[model samples]
Target: MKSAILAVVLAMPPQAILAEDVPTTVAHPRPVISEIVTADPARARRFPGVIEGENVATLGFLTGGRLASVPVEAGDQVMQGDTLATLDQVTLQQDLASARAALETVQAKATLAAQQFARAETLRARGVASDAMLDNARANRDAIAAKVKNARASLTRAEDAAQYSTLTAPTEGIVLSVLAEPGATVSAGSAVIKLAAPTGREAVIDVPEAFAALLPPDAVFSLRRDKNDTAATTARLSVIEPVAETSLGTRRLRLALDNPPKDYRIGSLVEASYATVSAPLMTLPRVAIAIAEGPNGPGVWRIEGADRRAHFIAVTLGNTIGDRVVIRDGIAVGDEIVTRGAHALTENQNVGDRLE
Candidate 1:
């Protein structure tokens, strides 16, 4: 029976055998979007900024009164302790006198109460005064002493107000604006003069939330007065506003100038740009990167030269600059990388010829 079956199979035509064979899946070299890896400095993002004082101040009195005189004007340079403005002294003096008289009255009353309290204690020791009488005398003395203390505090405050009536430069600075005029009645804490301190000047720039979010810690900025790039100088990020400006959705960045020019004065219009600190790093578009399918994860599809195959290589990502991201590792300069359809690619997939 076995010989008979073998003879019948051999007699079958070659076309019949070939037709019944299992088919094979064909994988063609896939066309890919790619970019040649190159190391270059990051594109700088420019912003408009202004030079401002380190700690600007608005001068005002602690107590409200009619302004007698304003000795300084906008753009005037004043030294520490220089008089900026003064309030009418008559009201302050009258208040001081009232405080003094009140204190004197309370002190006199306290003295009389002390004498009564002492006499009451003596009488009580002699068995001539009742315990209730001694207690009452002590209470009266305590109450009068408290009033004296309160009056003295009032007197001290009055004296302080006398000095507060005169507004003086707390520090050497240039007056930026005059808020109040002479003879104008102003309330306590009302702005009288705007003063910009001589030191702690910085560049004030509004950075969008997206850029500020990716701002590197060591990032430096180049500043130029107006549009003159010829006179550019460097600065370091010093401070950022905790809150974003509501209207523009941006944060205020304060960049401390490095050896700023003398012409970089207060309110100077300037332009700022971010500068990279380290050596030029490799960059790739967002589409070139993929998550997972890599041994270390968050990798890209790298195309090898000899085989022309795409392989998954995990990379360390640096700061995201604009649309491209910096690749810290896992690939070197001159390596071709897939920029599109990376996430859908499998390991060792044959990629078509490099589109140089």
Candidate 2:
């Protein structure tokens, strides 16, 4: 009987099939990349930096004098002991002459006193001079000798001042900046030029106060000349400035770069990247963060329970590290946060299992 009915239905035909005859397809939940909320992944935090010499020396004069000539300009590479600047040579020479004359006069007086003391000693031995007279002559000779010694010391100091009129490079390096010029009255120990040594180069970056505490010591930093540069250099954390910048609240950090390429010269602007092992705050991909409406700022879709329902969670945002941003408050560790395909998700929507 079933065969006869099937044959009759097949004969009934081409236009006889009804639209309701088709089976209804069941809709499954949407699949998403529900990544676990944790500390920032090993993505390095990149900071714009400038290359600087580690052994930076502030060159200045030893004697306060009118700057006669500043021969070397900024960016000039100089050798150790090379003349960088000079004070007034005429004034230095005059000072030396004055000191020499003073010394000569003192020496003449000392010689005359010695002769008088010897004559007094001879008279005292012959009973012609009294004991008090011999004592007076000896005291005069001693006082004159002391004056001569003081005058000689002053002459030596004057000679030194003459030599100090010339300011020379203390080490082999490039002149970073020239602060003083000719005819400028500069005091002793006043900086005239800034010099950076040829070696011990480093990278300097001003990190935001938000990430200052999270920075690890001796952390390796990837350095590059430009943002689109493919070739890069590396540096390690050397030191950090204790004081924060008053306006921006950023602390300066220095990283040691060993044997960097020739392009990594001092004052060259470069980008520095450092991957932190443990970030102070948890971070999520910017793609996962959604701008909330009204009082709520930014937020992320977090999945909960075995049912795999996504809930819109409001999060306070901090600094942005690359494509990721810091979550100052919002989610906790081990929370399932949707990293991919998060835009279309609704409140309490059932998202499918984590996508590979």
Candidate 3:
């Protein structure tokens, strides 16, 4: 009876619960981890931009007139004082001629008055004329002199008006647009031509308000068409507008391109980068971060023991630098951090095939 009781007890499933937990000795693949170290950080900011000339102007007529001849067309290169257009000058010419004739007549009268005054003075000196008579001659001479001055001034004004009938380039530049054609009437101060100075080009970019504050006054820039090629040229920060544009909520920044490309055209779209801030930072592969259940909440992968098993460590992450993130407090330098296969790991999970 005693032997049978011992056998029954032995057969009753060993009296201990065998928990089927994941084997700690199972050689699962370990994740590759890179040590976090302090290094120079790259400071970068991107902004949209367009190429533009330094000087741009809209040329206009100074006087109202019917356009008779437009000597230059759009895209025409002009020099200072080059004729751009001509107005109907027949009326102006007639007025100038009438003014000159009137001026000539006034000058003849003034000359006769001067001669009469001289004769009256000579007669008074010889006691042949009364003082009152001499005074009358002097007054007549002064009146004619005033008439002559007025006529000459009128002639000068008429000449200037005639000159205004012709349009000339104010400065050397490329003609970008022609508003009025031949036979079209243009009013004074109406834009007739668009001129762009060819000295150098400037790029205007709108920087986001967040990045604008971090940008340095003298930050360097590289301008390029694509990422594969080297930058065609470099630019320096020239202007930082004080006011932010209401529509874009961004600040305006101007960069002066040194030796701008020949293919650069006004209004051409461009990509620009502004180095805002830089500092030493720790970096790791993006795969090192993992979200797993922990005592508090979700956590990341961290090695704890000599076996390099993964530990679900809670981390407070900071700014991301490229593929890596800044760890605020969770992990430290010399800590073995799993970089890959982190998602498949669990707390206290044994791992094998450890990688450097």
| Estimated TM-score for each candidate | 0.70, 0.60, 0.49
Candidate 1, lDDT over the whole model: 0.86
TM-score, cand. 2:
0.60
Number of the top-ranking candidate, with TM-score as the measure: 1
Residue range 125-223, candidate 1, lDDT tens digits: 999999999999999999999999999999998898787888999989999899998889998899999999887789999988666766665568999
Q: What 10-residue stretch in candidate 3 is worst by lDDT?
A: 34-43
Model 3: residues with Cα > 4 Å off, grouped in runs: 1-48, 55-82, 115-133, 157-172, 177-194, 206-214, 222-234, 241-251, 275-356
- Candidate with best lDDT: 1
- Candidate 1 regions with alpha-carbon error over 4 angstroms: 1-26, 29-42, 55-69, 115-129, 177-194, 213-216, 240-249, 276-298, 303-309, 319-325, 330-336, 351-356
Give the per-residue lDDT of model 2 (tens digit) for 16-130.
4754586668767877887787665434567888888888889888877789998898888999999999999887788789999999999999999999999999999999999
* Candidates' C-alpha lDDT: 0.86, 0.84, 0.74
**Number of colliding residue pairs in each model:** 0, 0, 0
Ordering by TM-score? 1, 2, 3
lDDT of 3 by residue, 38-152 (tens): 4423345456688877888987777776788888876677999999888788867887899999999999999999999999999999999999989999999999999999999
